[model samples]
Target chain A: MSGEQTAAIESDIEAAIREDHPALITYITAGDPSLEDTKEYVEALDCGGSDLIELGLPFSEPIAEGPTIQAAINRALDAGTTPARFFELVDELETDAPLLVMTYYNMILQYGSEPDVRPFVERAADAGLSGIIVPDLPAEEADPLRDACDEHGLDLVFIVAPTTAGERLDRIMSQVSGFAYVQARLGTTGARADVSNATHDSLTRLSAYDVPKAVGFGVSEGDHAAEIIEAGADGVIVGSALVDLIAEHGTGDAPAADALESKARELKRGARRGGEQRNGHEQGREEAPEPEQP
Target chain B: MSETESNPPAEDEPNRERTFGDYGGQYVPEALMPALQELEDAYQRYVLDNEDGFMDEFRERMRDFGGRPTPLQRADRLSKRYDREIYLKREDLVHGGAHKLNNALGQVLLAKYMGKERIIAETGAGQHGTATAMAATHLDMPCEIYMGRTDVNRQRPNVYRMRMNGAEVNPVDAGSGTLKEAINETMRDWATTVERTHYVIGSIVGPHPFPRLVRDFQSVISAEARDQIQEQAGRLPDSVVACAGGGSNTMGTFHEFVPDSSVDLYAVEAGGSSLEIDQDEGLAPNSATLSTGTDGVLHGAMTKLLQTTDGQIVESHSVSAGLDYAGVGPELSHLVDTGRVTPASVDDDAALNAFHRLSNLEGIIPALESSHALGFLEEAHEELGDLVVVNVSGRGDKDLETVLEETENRDLDAAPDVEVFDT
Candidate 1:
């Protein structure tokens, strides 16, 4: 069962990319408002055409998160979220989108007092999680987590920043599995108004890797998702924008779930539009007459 | 200046190991990796190799501007009171009124050499912020400090000092509005500005290169104390004591003497109100990581942390704002685990008493953080051999208001009568 779940992440990503639309990955802090509300939100994302869903297991100190996610994490923690509670949320989640747990390293390292990662990874796999994303654990310190994930048949995903290059880039690319999270900008996770120019460069850098490249950070709207797909990303990860809606509307309300689904659908449509445009350009070039030999 | 001017070129080698027996690592986001690498390269070149005489310039500036070679004065009154030889390494004499300037000056100088135009740091109690602001101003770099709003309100003088030294102080209001939140905010800032900025970490904590880098810069405390003690006392002391917050002064005071098996090192932590944690509140009413903490990651390093069984970091408390931290330096954790250093703790009442005791007996006011070590001296002086050296990490001017108020509220044996001056 764990093996199938493990393969589901890569296959689901591949399936999304193979279609006319790029994959859409949406993130939200689990247990926010409440775990029951979280399950409903996950369903909303899946119904809205999300290919992958990331459930944040909120840590006490989330150094990689900006103001929006930080506020969301605080809310989740206040709702009594713990590792055990997070796993229960995974067990109860009903969704077609492949699930990934995103958190800080200490949550995985301190799951049990034996100072090993196996306990957390094995439990995550058993709970039906397809992969794990730890923002603070770089490739240099990823060996232990990677080994644990491999033993548990879970994908160990890594985030590649805009500044990543040369030997460091090689190190990260080698360690990454399922999909490489390409940070669109050089900062913590949050929403921004403009799509960064560095998105194209980061995607071009990761093009050599066989793994799918999903661009994230500052991707707040449908146009941002479209721009990322046109820039050669295999997917777009949206978090704070959806979280803003959740914050605006209280949990268990129909309007809150509807708002999340609406945003996800808009973003997915934009992604498909961008993919169609790119495919058209490629086909046009292929059908164009070759240059005459001089 | 020309004492053996002929020196060999530094060996070109990669940076040293990132961990102290599995206690330290670069547990940070991917965006900060390149900056760490760049800083590592600069650390090797300028700090380790003294490329273009960087260390030489650092030493000269420290001597002229920052006042290095702080005296290791024998505390005659303290020795007589304790019935043992007690010596004080007066790091309190350094510029910016604490040992914080040692690492701040070195990192700020290294940043200039690395061609960085901006400097940033996080501080609790505003000690590190003041030091970094002074260093940046001395080196003519634009400086900014992230301090908790709680600390800014509590330690107003230090905030003013930092601002007067020409630094932008950004108040962080996240979480408990304390040191931990301040550090997180600084890391966020550095993530965005890593290309043109350098973050001057306050202590022997953080990821690879930072702990080692700060230790190397701060080891001057022990380097000077080791020679001064031998020169004054005719031999190495039996025990060396220093207060451990994030363990900068502790590591600095003990690093040079760690090789001497006969020299016992004691890291004194803050016991705050109690040792027992309020589990429901997720609060540890102490900052005694060396004595009571378990292995966990915080502030980019895998170190000993005052965290709950479920892995959430609990809020830590101490009378001394500088010592109120949930996590400690990884190297100190390694040392305590290996049994090379003994871990001890002193409660708030004892620390406050010692604050007044030192002022009355030695005619020198001691920082509350350093008073924890002095407090331990009152508790375990006989156990520590006949000769002991205590690191006075800073002066107590900043803690005057806190100490006076605390003393007024509590009945302390050493505290002078304040009722006479009630008017």
Candidate 2:
């Protein structure tokens, strides 16, 4: 839990955002089929061009997840995924990309014999986790966890929904470390056939915040990644789409790891293509606009 | 807590405390924060401040449509049997046959004032759904209810009652298909439809404004009972007992009397078959959260919960669907922790026995949820002072099938003989 270790996630995300292309963030439920499979999947995602990976510590009541991830969580829980076991998996993982633990607030609150956030945050930092994402912990109730994360030097990422606005949005942005998770839609996390219009509006709304913005929710394919990135997101997050692959192929299946790797590669390429197109359009507009000025 | 101080400030003061001690807070997704904020504003203006004659209309509607001020009857047979003056707060007499309408009606009316176009809610035993449906129909608002598929099948009559009152019952089939899942599904709906829809949480649970909001509406139960007992019995009762599930009725019956230190408040939970939790299976054999639960966050609030050592919420059990919840209201958790309210529990057999005893002795059939309180009285009446007031939270009409099926499986000492009649 050293200060240098705690700053890993924010620094890694910042470096990734500074690259020529938008950062690609991939998510998979830890211990979905088995912890061994999760380790392999994380390595695959990292090698396939993921800038950061989020490992879900399965909670029994994941109100923030949709059917695909919920089924994966139930599978992980049935296979006996616990907070202690999740940390052990994180400790064992070897990946090029920094890792974060996405879980419900209760798991952190009840990590020890009593309800305290420090014990869990300290353990997360020790396990080499760069940041933590709690969908249920809004800015209004995030002070204790934020303080704990600050003390532990781990980033505390907050999700900003389309409905989020005004003073609340300002408060959340001020507290957020690493990248602010910008929900691409108004609902819970799931993969959709197309990117939502709300994604563009939300990115515009969050333009004033200094934190890097990563758009998630309803992001399914390479095109979705490209669309979100083109609309001005620093990163693109895909979860349900990757989890759907695990659900389709049992973790024991040899192709499961390969499927995740291929999907990650495609999403990363789309993000790069989007960055090139946006830069080209901006340069074209700058060169052609002077004569039309009134 | 004083009535005025209990109302939170309208503005979002960063330092304002939204919790009851260490419990309660808006532990919900960012999408629902605006809805909670809007609801808080509406609650403060219309509910606490009574803006636009809101409280006047609400009280008038309760009297005209909901049969408010349900009588406080002195149970003659129960008084003699317990050797004390037993008073029953007859909440079962409220319209829709449960104390649920007190909160449901108030929330629905408040939604109308806030200009919400639709209403949504979740129910376990269907009492809350039925009450909300009735209120919505009475108020001319569209309504929908999320009910577990398991409960939808078992509580058919209440399901039909809800449908008859014009509510679409969506059966949630996820994770055990029970109250917990229904609540999650309802929350999911609210998260997506926050602007146009208002989710009427049936109990005094959930985030900051809801627990306080629901409590204010349901407090009418104690508001009347406290005055009724003083006039009827010439003094306040020594002990007040109510069943605890999500604790709407318990909080409703206890809110007015909490400051009266002389009077004792008891929240009787359903002990089911046992209190021992099977850690390996992630199951708790009872719904006795107040009695044996640890502090954990659930359903948007930091409350007492039945959870495993690894922080996984365990599946809870109770023969009575209404009492089958793993979490209790955060306010109740604070009350129990501070020792303002005593926590007790009764087994399923005892609750079943009390259901029959009240029917046979006093000609009043009690809901299985309410039977838990009656069972507690039967177990510890001698310790209660000369006067005791018990809240009959609902009628037993919805529990006839469940009681009959459960009674046939066990030999309840007080159960009336029911030999199968020749078909």
Candidate 3:
């Protein structure tokens, strides 16, 4: 808590990996129902054992998002969510887990003067944001913003897709400070009943690097989370499912928090299942080696 | 016209960077980077420099199916009226009734070579949609086109034509229901279905390779016009003029002649209401990105875009649905910066006037988009040399309803006043 923001995020992820626990990252579009609801949702996620919280700065067009997240963004925009409002909401968050802002490149590019993305990273640092993820800004086009983020003590996370080439993956991994986001599928963000082999393959490829690799997109259930963790993902990132839960059960409903709490716990249990099985082979005769910190 | 004519072309600037100044880069999501790279590699290997006869096959298809080498006809009647040499590059004679076929045919063929099973496209004015449909049918590929609800309603004939040619048209009602929103939807579709699908972008726009590739395919218009004009008119035209929307036709007609110092390139934008109107007043004049726009990214590429100070893309207004756009192609933006391509705008009123003039005087109906280029003739008459080739990008068959309505409105305005008295 006393160190720099990005260093704190890196250490936090490293600590989780050392503990042999998959970091549970929860994402919700800020100001979906309202900013107030979002604040409560953040607290709920933190209490529910989320290792990291991703606040979606709603854009007019969320192209990478599917129906659920897109509708959430639309609702947030209708509620008059702006980048200023997003930062303001983030300023109000009092949570144990690190907070990151996920947004499109244009929103950040538009925040300051033309062609200068530094102001955004400066503002994120000033606002106490641990990291920033631009899903649309690939590593190749992320140099300017990445430099600014590095200057402002903000971790710049890049996305690695199933379709990403080996060389491009290496390039992305080289630049990432926080965990690298590995898309769980070839399509837009949505929840599916079963994860595809492509997801496992992407995670396996991403595992070669030293970066913490978290898998998202179509990660809806505990089994889905477990499948990814079993395949060697360091973290599980869930978005649509939580948004869907929020939609089904209003923030006012006790069941909503309960559902989130249970879901988080179940996914955590699923995450531990892989390590537990590994430990079972030793049968208490020998202890497993502790994961190294970054 | 004054600035473009006086300013010289920057022959050295094209080699600067991957971007056109600060415009034209891959501004899309990371999910699309691999796809764009794959496309670039495929384009270089299979289409541009492959040992296989892919380029030949593409040319053969362009010749047999697309009817390439569309004529460059000298406009004798228009020349006499304007008292200037005016010629037309007949893209209208292309199989799909516009230059859109050039891009569609090449992309669909590329998609075929890449082993993609389906083709997806976004279209405005239905010209690109109809052309994509034609390519899809000819290649026996599944095709889906996203069209704005307003465009679908207005360009009903082209919509019908798209369906008749075997393509599904998804009507997008988002964001003023125009070309911009349609592109957003198509990008979403491509993101989800990139494995089996290829996005056949209709213009010299979008992210890299798209603008470059589409311009390369459509450049045949100017290439042919360059030679055809030399053979017929016995010299290069003084200026090359084409309507600019996403700027494929204009770039196609202008790209080959970029190094030609003497040849002036003029891009006529759809002036909609008027480029002179205050953009903040909620009355946006479409296709004036070059005139009243600042450089910003939209639809994927960094380009001159009609946007707010906060970078929110402003909706463009145009009577010509084909020319209704908030952003121009990135290369056009560079050309505009280097004073290579001169940006000219024609309001809806004048474009309609030109549409009527061409129909009546030359017995040829031009699309409202093409009418913008014809509309520029009034301004360029003084600057014209012995030869000026205007890219007649498309025929006006799809615009009959809009033309007929405007004509009726004009006729009603001209009707004699009648007074009625009751006893």
lDDT preference between candidates 1 and 2, better one:
2
Q: Give per-residue CA lDDT, model 3, range A1-294, as digits (tens).
A: 112434444444445434546778889899887888888778888888788889999776567888889888877877777788888888878887888999887778888876578887888888888889887787778889878976877778788887886788777777777778888887788878998898878877766677788889999888888778878888889999998987788645334667777777777677667445534544465775653322
Ranking by DockQ: 1, 2, 3
TM-scores computed on chain B for all candidates: 0.96, 0.96, 0.92
Per-model DockQ against the true two-chain complex: 0.77, 0.76, 0.58
Error of 1 at B330 (Å): 0.6
Reference contacts preserved by each model: 0.83, 0.77, 0.61
Give lDDT tens digits, candidate 2, residues A1-294: 112334444465556555534889999999988888898889889989999999999988888888889899999998888899899999988787889999999999889778888899999999999889999999889889989988887778899999999998887777778888999988788999998989999999988766788999999888888888878888899999999998889756435888999999999988877766666676787863332111
Where does candidate 1 stray beyond 4 Å? A1-21, A251-255, A288-294, B1-15
Tens-digit per-residue lDDT, B119-204, candidate 2: 99999999999999999999999999999999998889989999999999999988999999999999988988888999999999
Q: Candidate 2: list runs displaced more than 4 Å.
A: A1-10, A287-294, B1-17, B420-422
A-chain TM-score in candidate 3? 0.88
Candidate 3 lDDT (Cα, 0 to 1): 0.80
What lDDT does the true structure give each of the candidates?
A: 0.89, 0.90, 0.80
